[model samples]
Target chain A: MLNLNNLLLQVIRLLLTFVIIFLTLIIFGVSPFDVFESILYGSLGSYSKFIRTLIVWTPLCLSALALIYTFSAGMWNIGIEGQIIMGAVGATFVARSFLGDDLISPYLQILMAMFFGGFWGLICAILKIKGKVHEIFSGLGLDFVASGIVIYLIIGPWKRAGIASTSGTDIFHKASWVPTVGDSNFPIFLIILVLFLYIFSLIIFRYTSLGIRLKATGINTFATNRFNFSSEKYIVFSFLIAGAIAGIAGFSQSSGAYHKLVPSVSGGFGFLSILIVLICSRNIYFTFIVSFLFAALIVGGSQLQIKLGLDHSLIGIIQATFVLSWLVLQKIEIEKITYKQISKMFAK
Target chain B: MILLENTLVTVISLSTPLIIAVIGETISEKGGVINLSAEGTIMICALFGFIGAYETDFAVVGFLCAMVLGAGISFFISYCDINLRMDQIAVGFVLTILCINLSNFLGQDYVRINGPLITKFSIPFLSDIPFFGSVLFNHSLITYLSIVLIPLSWLFLNKTSYGLAIRASGENPSSASSRGINVKRMRLLSCVMGGSLLGLAGASFSLYTKYGWSEGHTTNYGWIVLAIVIFGGWNPFRAAVGAYSFGLLQVLAIKAQSVTLALSQILPLLPFPLMIFILIFIQYINRDEIKNVPKWIVAILGGNQPQSLGKKLPEEIK
Candidate 1:
């Protein structure tokens, strides 16, 4: 669905955006050039940094992909954080069990994580469907509840031997880690899973009847009744699918990144993925590209504190501005206007 | 008795910020807007409120500045919803993230810095009214104002004509416009008013209740306020009760901290789960599933979510 013409327009717009960012940085009394240079160097400078970006990208892209399911089905799915947490809990369960030292533990963790995350999501769906609660409220409530459960498990049942702490259970056994490629730690397992899911999703949305129905349900819930499909069922289906995908994101975080469960197992990436999904506007292709760029931004944001003597939060401010501008510019029809201007030049 | 009295007093005093914020949110919701940016709005306002007081040496100035910023933020959200035809929840959610990080970024220098404190002031005659006076009157000026706002805002929402218009706009904007009301302006106005009150609530946290500025000074309190507004069922008076109950929970949580590492952390989050139940109950009542639910039960607990809350104003209305 994407073409080179629109891509060129986006680049032109990106240049204009950089100018605004440059001015904002100046107003904050920082050297914009230095800030940009450091971010570039930090994320892409070394082989290790590039590997780190891939690690962040795996879970992030997974979450964004998961969000697309619900977004297409027209639900906010804010309980995504809880789903991610539950997935980690599921993985941790396998990591700490009798199977802890076995190579097959990672595979078991994947299934358990999917079930746990899917069930948590199912709870939100049931609340909204049967109990008449809005998804946002139920989702928000479930998010806190899930986090509370994680904290309880960390400090209560799953605490490290001898002394309990919130830093997280001791790092899991190496057998449970996402199988990496070599010394460079390429995380081949996670990258493969991400690619497989993205391809699966693109096919689901493009060629499948179920995907078409989900979009139909999203666009107009009442209208779906005319087609004899239950919108509520699709809502449930979407949450379950989204939650399961988000759970895989949790697996990626646990096995691919930390390799253990922590109180903050989700690491706020679920919410960041929401921001990514917003900018992508449910476009699956854009979601991948945007998620990768954002992962780099986050990986790079650490450099702000170490090298530039700046707060890492500047990354958030920049991203938020990008979303706000994206939403507003979309309303302004920037693409159409750009397309028109370029066409006029070509005709002349 | 003394321990209970003291706890009650502390609950009234500490709940000051929450009560003000809940009332603010109730007003916005009543006018058919969610102001879902409560979390971020309160966060940034708390930072600015502390900074304003720190720079000027007057807590009042800090509050005023916070109110303006709060109003400004709400106005921006409403503009997107009403004018740009965007989703209210999406904009508010984005703003929450933006303001939260913005506050942390801007507030980096002010973290743990000392600022002016809001002082206690008992009403001249009210303080002598035995148990009631001690529990409600003898507290910071902001506390008294928050307590007073409960009844006043209730009257404003249920008694006054302007209140009716705002409620009408939220309840059914199309009907409201058909009746010659300006739904857009009403929403915008209420959003700004509520946003400013939210700002006040944020400032109160820094200057009065919690005291001083820090990164995420108000933190999850904003989400707590959003929950309370619903728990209160969108009524200022009931919402105040909900806010105070949360304050009581906080106090108990602090006391329970000595008992276990996990209990304290979990107690304060009690409201979110409870809010979900309350929301479900409200729906159950709407469906008339339980015929025996008393009228007061519906009135007090909540059967009153604005029909149009968190939705865009219809294009036809514009």
Candidate 2:
């Protein structure tokens, strides 16, 4: 009976979430049903389109996983945007300088790229820990510095005379690229990797001491401290892990497809990750599903730009609407809980 | 030598909006409510402030319209956070995103249109002071209002009755409630007032400086103001200092472009690193007190304070 009740609750929330999505599209003067159809056909339209969604979904999934870790520990790091940028910067720096066209040894470059990205995120964590700065503001400030660094690279050190665009770094040889599966195939390997992450996260969340300790810290820092748990260290570690995952996502986006560094490589994936986390309510397995759904929306929404004359940003609006609705639902749940508790206390 | 004066001027002028916004934020925080929606308020006002002024050709009208827009938006945040009991930080963030997109969508057509600029006036004798006259006295009335508001805020905070009530609510809600104060109402008022000030600042930019509506012309002043509020220690005077310091960095960066090769290369980024370093320094100096300040204040200022909800009650009937 309890299981049935929980299942019913899940179904209601899912239906509410869809209603929110539909309402959001309607507000923008688009039909949700038509857009939904477009999203389905857009991703599965052709073999090539299906492959494209996977390419986008892989990095998005990695970053979402990283975000879930940080958010669960009660840290809101807006620096994923910059972290990803630095990842690409680091990757480009390595691929161009040392591993240019060397397919035999790109693995080392990839590892270095991940390190640099993670290292940048660590800078934010260290600043928060040692310097006492708040994570959100520091992350925001760091993002600006990172943006300036990218622009500086394009205008100064890595400027190309012939290319008029703002993009920096040179194009990589085909050999330096991360290998895709059979001809025009998406990276199916991501499925296996993300699945592993989902299972690992589920196990850790359900059974591990670290998970319990982290939740305790999140719920009540004073009580957690009384129990001798170092909340600060755990939070910093969460940021480090989150930053590393975001870093990998950045490196993947650049090397797997673009082959050249562009400013939009992160493509607002950081903000989207926040939405995915909220919708899934910090559940790792749920995030994997939502991230792919988001990828489909982006992949399909872009097609809407051409087919339905919708703005490219409609995807952002759709995602934002979903997040806002989830928040409303979450708010309702909190209200009910608070009402129950407070009413009882007042009764006493 | 000439470049120094030019840099000085640019910094002072550029820092004006942040100064105005952060001062309002300081008031909101002192009263113990966080207004995370300042970003949205600022952006929407910046967009519509231009539209109103451009259509009507009145700078004052533009400023007034922006304040209304900001206040209206802030009401939603206050309602959500207070009445609906939503997570303040999360609500503010979501509202911020909403305002950004809404402004972007609204301002898409207004980007090319220009608005009337607020005319600058010099105060009689003080306006005659050599360097200070041109740099300080020769700006719009709104800029001058922001300057005067600093000391005025200090007085209001230290010497006023309502101010004390607001501060009390922020410091200890239960104690204040026992004293017969309406804590929620004070918070709602502060949120709206702070939001209005931010809106006015957004309007001032279009009316006095940018002289037109641009989608991103506010350029994260909301975030910067939030940072400055923290850097200011939630005090209006301190926030002014932080604002000016940031202003100085922006000025120096622009001026250094003609003087050095490398400085120009990364000069735009200079303010960010400086802001981060300053924030870290402030946090280090006030670590103990920093933790003690209310969560609402931290949320309002966009600092790294925990997103606090009211304490949970006992499970069984009392």
Candidate 3:
């Protein structure tokens, strides 16, 4: 499925991205080499660090996968951030209830997260379909609305005993937390879930008409009219599925990562994944790989403060620069230009 | 009477940046480009504005720096939209993320440090007037500029030949090109102009109203400006009204804070939901079925979105 030339071009583009990031860091008085080394060693140097990277990867990858669904249907789904938040809210609702101690609480959180996330996604779809609102603006508005709901929950009815703060809700019941294996606190449950979802997504796209219809809806809204099915229905369908998947990501954040619902429960993974899918597009395998790399970057960024005395905001700068540079480079066909120049040089 | 005067003054002064920024976005949109990076542009510009003032100790330099930064960003977006054939929204979206983080990273040193503040200049005769003076006249130069900008931009866009050329390009590039207009150049010029005002608004936040630099300073204001622009329906006067209404909302929010924290937190986000509702309303009003809608209602609530807002320019006109 891969060609040497494409791989070569990809490598060249990645190197260029790194060069840009490296130069940007030097301008900020940071050593590019040291930063790279630190990030590598911090994320993958040890088993525990790698595990932390995995924790970050679960949601990052899940959101990327979720984005594929909506993107294929030509939907922006920028409200994916809000959908993730609502998913956390859904999980927190179950965890704080009479079922908090039940063994089924974690399982139930998954369903509730899906329901809540899907419902939030449905709102975006409806706004676009009936209200004729652009998904970007509607999604942006819904994101703020979701955050408002989260802040309200944290500071009002869900406030801690004798103190109300925007910090977060009480920790979810231990039983509701994503179950870990042994003394290593390995996130086996989350890993299994990721694997299952990936395989499920592969099968759905490869073997079913749903995938074809969604792609068709994305390619041309009117073209689907000749096929006798409304593209609007597929838009709604993709949004629901995307939102459901993104909700699971939120569930992972609340249960596996933080073990509680915070005001910023989404942790920006939704937005980050949007960037990832922008470059990766509908390539599922690429999404998986890119999300892992981004996860490592994020996980390792936590080390910047302690080891290098650098602020973690540098991580944001690097991620954004990498994505922006990559997008610009791809748009201009830097690889093609480079190849042309190289051949010309050889001929000369 | 004094209480009402104080409230009105606060509302007028506080709404300055929103007023300026909305007009800037309106200018950009009127040229057929949606600069979605408003949130991040204001953020980064706010930081640089504070840095420029804090370092140089001159408020004017800060405003200038932010204006350049904002204009440069819009220039980049327009350039990419025209030459590189990239999606305007995607490019703007990535820039927003990059600019916001870049500000956070670079601004770490400048956070919470007091920068130069804009001084109030009350007109001697105007300030003595009974009601309008207290509410409108006794304010800083930038605030006065914002007030003036409302009508000024309205005139420039409605009456000027340059404004007509830009509007023609936005409405239909092919037709405008046929009329001997350089569509690409007009878009670039208008985007830069709009972006500069956005930068001015960013500096206004730091140097005038919400003074001092901090991480995430001027948060949500950029998005709120976008919402208000839509609420204004592409008319400078209407957009100014939307900005002022938001300022009133913020004033009410501050007062509500003492009553309850939850309400206070929720009130600020009201613009977003209201944005959604207004958009839906606009769509409904624009529908063909609504044949008997009152002209007055259209004047007040009707939003005449740009004919080619957010769409790609078709062919280049030299």
Candidate 4:
């Protein structure tokens, strides 16, 4: 019965979302058909656009997967943004340490990125476990501090010489750049790495004792104690894993796409991944499709700017409306159940 | 003497928005709802308020528009959390991102554009009172109103029957409902009231304090306001003090930058980490294992959050 209600809610949410998007397009004085055509052309029409979608899809997929662990553990890892930033910072630090030397492998830099990102996540975990600070506040505080650190680096010490541009550090040596497919910057290796991690996580989540323990811990921390499983250890481990994956997502953004660090390297991917996770509602298969669609929306949003003179951020409105309406519909379903129950009681 | 007076003035002006925001949050939390969309709400409100004032050439109209938007957004958050049984934090976090993106998208044209500003008004008698006059009397009407709100909020939370109901709802909603307080309604009202104040704070930024609309305008102030609420132990007076001190720190960070070039860049970053440290420090001191601490020290440092905060009231109550 609950499954049926959820399915009904999902269908209603999809219809309402379309209606909202259609109305929004009308309000902007743009034809829905034209915008849809442009979006289709921009996201999947040509080879270059398809690759661009994949470039966005890679990190978004990784970040969404990273969030799965934390969300499964009943944690709000809102600090994923900070972890991603720190990961980029870590990778940059390693790349810059070579001082333009061509000896250090880019692979090593990615590893360092994961380490630093995981360390940052561990710090948030420690705050929760020891300091009793809520992860949400602690994570938020860290995000601000991390961004401040990045801005300070770009403008102060690590700034490009002579002009102090917010353009970020000089591009890492070509050796530091992740290898791409022929004639295209498509990060084939990173894509494979992300896919491997995704498959590995899927298997672990389904078949392993660790996954069961984590799920049990999340569902009832007290019950986990009764079962003699240390929920804290699982929680911390989940954060560490999530942070590392998110770190690699950050590394992918810098090394794979931009070839250098910028202040906005994460490109709000951390938050976008959260939306994807919520929309998927813990279904792994759904996560893959949603991440791809979200990536298309983002890529296509930029097209709206070029083709229709509409702000790309129109995508934000659509996405927000989707999540908000989905939530509202879920609430309505619950209200219906309760209303029916009350009416039955009155009749009796 | 001159430098101290100047710094104090800056602090007072800077803290007004925070004061308003913290009071609103305090009220909302007192009624057992945590409006975590504060950061995004403030950003959106700042943008909308600026656009309204810019279009209408009236700061008052901008503030009114902002309050309405804030209330509307708050209503949505409450409706989702209360009626839908959604996680308040999750819904709030999503709303924050949504509003932020919406503000950026919609306010693209308004960015860097000049807008109407609230004029500073000083009471004649108060303006001549030496130290107090310069420190307190020489500010705009909005700033004065925020100052007044500190005391008014405290009284409202502690004195009136409604205030008692709010506190009762936050502390023990089940009992409060049993006593016929209508906990859900109280929570809804508190959220709307708090959200309106947040809107006022956002307007204060574009219309008065920061005095401009730009992308990322009034950045991170919302988070700082949240920090101040925790630091203030969720009390209006204490939160106001925390906001003022934070403003002083920001001023000092700027001043220090002039004193030393290389270190100054890093100095501005100090407040965020320091706020986090303070949050942790408060928790540490408040631990049950701690002994030998003075009574007043414990009272001032420890924050006892509302017991029933973030929990959904049982539907059977209604």
Interface RMSD of each: 0.8, 2.7, 0.9, 2.3
Itemize residue pairs with steric clashes in candidate 4: none
Query: Which pairs clash inside model 2?
Result: A348-B318, B34-B300
True contacts kept of each: 0.80, 0.51, 0.81, 0.65
The whole-model lDDT of each prediction reads 0.89, 0.73, 0.90, 0.83
Residues B257-302, candidate 3: write the lDDT tens digits.
8998888888888888988988888899888657888899878888
Per residue, candidate 3 scores C-alpha lDDT tens digits across A1-348 of: 989987888788888988888899999999988988899989998999999999899999999999999999988878999999999999899999999899999999999999999999999999999999989889999999999999999999998878988899988889999988976878999899999999999888888999889999998999998999999999999899899999999999999899999988899999899999998967999999999999999888988888998888888889889988988877777767878999999999
For B258-301, candidate 4 gives per-residue lDDT tens digits of 66543555554555676678678777776756678788877766
Residues B84-173 of candidate 2 have per-residue lDDT tens digits of 676666667777777777777667678866558777777788878887777777776888888898898878776888788767666766
TM-score of 2: 0.85
Q: Which whole-number lDDT from 0 to 100 does residue A147 have in model 1?
A: 89
Judged by whole-model lDDT over C-alpha atoms, candidate 2 comes out at 0.73
Chain A superposition TM-score, candidate 3: 0.94
Clashing pairs in 3: none
